[model samples]
Target: MLSKAFPRRMTVFVLVMLLVEFLDEFTFGVTETAWPFIRNELDLNYAQIGLLIGIPLFLANFIEPIFGLLADTPRRRLVMVGGGIMYGVALLWVASSQSYAMMMLALILLMPASGAFIGTAQASLMDHEPDRHDQNMARWTFAGSVGMVIGPLALGAFLLIGSGWRPLLVLIGGLMMLAAFIVWRLPANAALRSHASDADDAGEPEYGLMDNARLALGALKRPAIWRWLILLQFSDLMLDVLFSYLALYFVDVVGVGEAQAGLAVAVWSSVGLLGDFLLIPLLERIQGLAYLRISVVAELILYPAFLLVDDITLKLVILGIIGLFNAGWYAILSGKLYSALPGQSGIALTLGNVGGLFGSLIPALVGIVASHYGLQAAMWVMLAGPVVLFIGLPWRTDKPIKLEESAAK
Candidate 1:
């Protein structure tokens, strides 16, 4: 009875989980746009910016595994709830920061908090529909894309209102606090009867923290897990690493001001929003890996053209196309990681964090290149993302069964 009524019983559970992704990306969207302004106010240079971004990510890889281990425990709610509170607090700390060190300290705190809150929700979502990992990830990515669209636009709006990134972050932080309260208010009753109550999300945990950690680390030995994990990091060069540098590139190299730079980021994210929305349905008709083969090729061409274009308007157009091509990159790649480690989404999250420890340095590396050779020179490094994807992706993998065929059965 509970299994049959699960979706009905736990609609709120799914919604809350998706909302966490939204807030996480929303923070990114705003912060990514605010970087140029943040640099201006703080008088920061590229190397300093690199450290500000890299060190936190380096440390968070160590911290996030702890939370991933906690995801299946009796304390899952407390962990998530506390993570949400800290998420808000960390953002507020950024808003209050007066020095580069203070802001850096806040981001270091923010990353792990995000890993705990958002990572737990993502793992639960993957566990919720173990059989439809790609499909569910598409849905999750769509939710996040909406926030990505809202993020820069919200920052732009704040700038228009004589407020700025700091005030906008304050608003985003307050919303996180509200999200935490709602997380707290949900009663752990029959509500988790379906999607939420599945052993992945709400059942009594089967392993202690150390046991879970051991299992998660053990899974890393599988080539299947390593393949997706490595690809995930490499692909991110064009996805996130590219996005992080975009505003600065626009400001310094493209001859644009902060407002226009925000617009460029908005255009990138809005097209990504469209792509994410379209991908949810597209996944039904084609294999996720099949889609990746096509999209990666397209991005290989588009990303280079984006950097070479002399006109900002043409650059925006190219960026939108690149965003479109890369829409399902994270969704499909991560879904594969979960599939590779079946029944272990929490472990998959840990694996991703571990993998991230290396990729996290990519931005700082890019920043160093930009500082030495200039931002335009550094932009070319992003091309490595697609080049590796073209080489590393297995031409033949995934079960022979098509998703549409699986659905019919």
Candidate 2:
């Protein structure tokens, strides 16, 4: 039986993870917030801008599997510490970058650094209490939401006050370095470690690169897994990539000032944060798949309204409600995927990375379309995202093996 102390320890771990995520996201948020300014300063074309965002994310997909593999080991916590440091350093590098090539190099470094912490962190959370995976993931998303809320607002404030964007990078880098220190000092929770030891004792074959590769290849044979990947990639188009462009969209298309656009992003995140908080309790009442289906349907309706509606305040309100509905899709999706794969956290996370890689292309694709057809027309492409989700992902999933228990078999 798990000790009562495990929950307390897990709580501490989650809090520390929250701080780390805040710092990580603040750095990324700075980049996103500064992007419009960066585009203007660099005089970059849409395709060039797309490459800037897409290439680093694409490279990160390759790194995620390796990090996922590492997450399954005893050194998972230590890996997060290293990742935090790398993330900070990369942000500093981005701060000093004078050319597109230099910025590109710095972003490339950021991707692997991110992979180091993210999958490991998720594995840690789920391993702490498999039964509470959904709740725990809600908290995980909540933490990220907090960071997302703070990041753009901070950058926006700086921009509003005439401090410019580069200083925000330096500030974020310093905070990231602090986050690394905090993670390094984090107490090791015995429950997750014990689970690791139990799996080792159960004579699970040590998975090497080749073994993991074989598993990944074998996973492709399952329609459910790849189907989930496709759905997720499209969902990201609306959820992730769409937000990435939100500030710029408001500025360029909606005829808003940069600061207001920043606020729009902040509104989106703030509501999402509250929604994540609510989602914890809501999960008790609503089934995960059903909730996801409902949320997607809501988005299917809300997104078009957001585009067609002229009032910025109304648009903000719509985005907040959309945030509320979309809150738990990732948590549910990740929990289900992890449940399906059992011990293969690395492969499961790698699948997300693969989806993210394709999803990264959406920004570039939108940029290309926007260049020819205009920004408003480009956004119409996003409608395909929810439509795909509704079509591809079903409301029911096959029973998934609990990886921790299966390890003992």
Candidate 3:
């Protein structure tokens, strides 16, 4: 029943979904770049700033499973469009917030919207090209890497002109709305409604909240799943948590100008973009887990060096290399995890979010430590992340659980 042009349409659909991912991470990247200014303007303490950053992810722990369930339903396109629009509105709310409580509230709304868009988009990608999970994920993350690079630069341009954070927020909001509109106008088949109907006819089970919960629990029971979840937690702590605070660290500790600090953040992302671009070729030759192991070990060496070095330029160079090695980790782990749970991609991703629940606490904990001992000391906490990742990753490769075989139970 599919048209001859379905492959082209699917490619276009994936590009649109990548744009959605771009907008989401771009917003977060802008937020990270703007954090120091926001902190100064609002007189926020480290703990409050941490709360601003961490609470949304903490809430997403619960919210992701709900969206994950929606991804399994016929309303997937609605979820993607509606969630993208809500995220845009939430960014406007963030722009208008005058208090820490208001900022936190805006972020809380932002997280679920993001979760809805992300869960559905990933599901749609897998649904369209079931055999190409690794390649598709690489493409997905590559788009996000490009966004992360551009986001800070865009914000930096605004900062250079003295337009400040509010205008940047407004700009990101507008982009998200535009992304939503594009998704809404996609054709019925592009939205994969026919695929959903076919699966329903084929007797694939409909997942209510209880069904989602059961699947999530079953996912948790698998050792491979939990190990990968733990690996994701540590990986996020190392890369994302570190990134969110990097600009602040540069401004507060390294005595850099604010715009320069934003540039530092941009450099990290730019190198990551390069690394992701290079990853496409490497993936063709290397196994995902093997690549992950090598990358993690490299981070073990470079992360400490970046933290300990006193020269600003040298440190920035080290950060760039760190981003290079950090490139394929999420794609690999995600591809492997999804492979282990073929039909249950939503639950698999939700289980990763469950790990994110605890991982989200690291920012707040680091904030508390920074408040007392300084950010330099707070950064030392990051050492544990890679160590945990290296130890916890399923290195042996023989233990992957086949969730599709037992998902009914």
Clash counts per candidate, in order, are: 1, 0, 0
Evaluated at residue 206, the lDDT of candidate 3 is 58
TM-score of each: 0.91, 0.89, 0.92
TM-score of candidate 1 relative to the true fold: 0.91
Best by TM-score: 3
* Local accuracy of candidate 3 as per-residue lDDT tens digits, 54-86: 888798778777777666666667878888899
- In candidate 2, stretches whose alpha carbon ends up further than 4 angstroms from where it belongs are 1-10, 189-206, 401-409
Residue 26 of model 2 has an lDDT of: 61
Least lDDT summed over 10 consecutive residues: which range in candidate 1? 399-408
Q: Where in model 1 is the C-alpha error above 4 Å?
A: 1-10, 189-205, 398-409
List model 2 lDDT by residue over 330-390, tens digit each: 7777777766776666667767776777776777888788888888898889889888878
lDDT (0 to 1) per candidate:
0.83, 0.75, 0.80
Q: Model 1: per-residue lDDT, tens digit, 83-166?
A: 899999999999999899899999999989988878887887776666788988998999999998999888888888899989
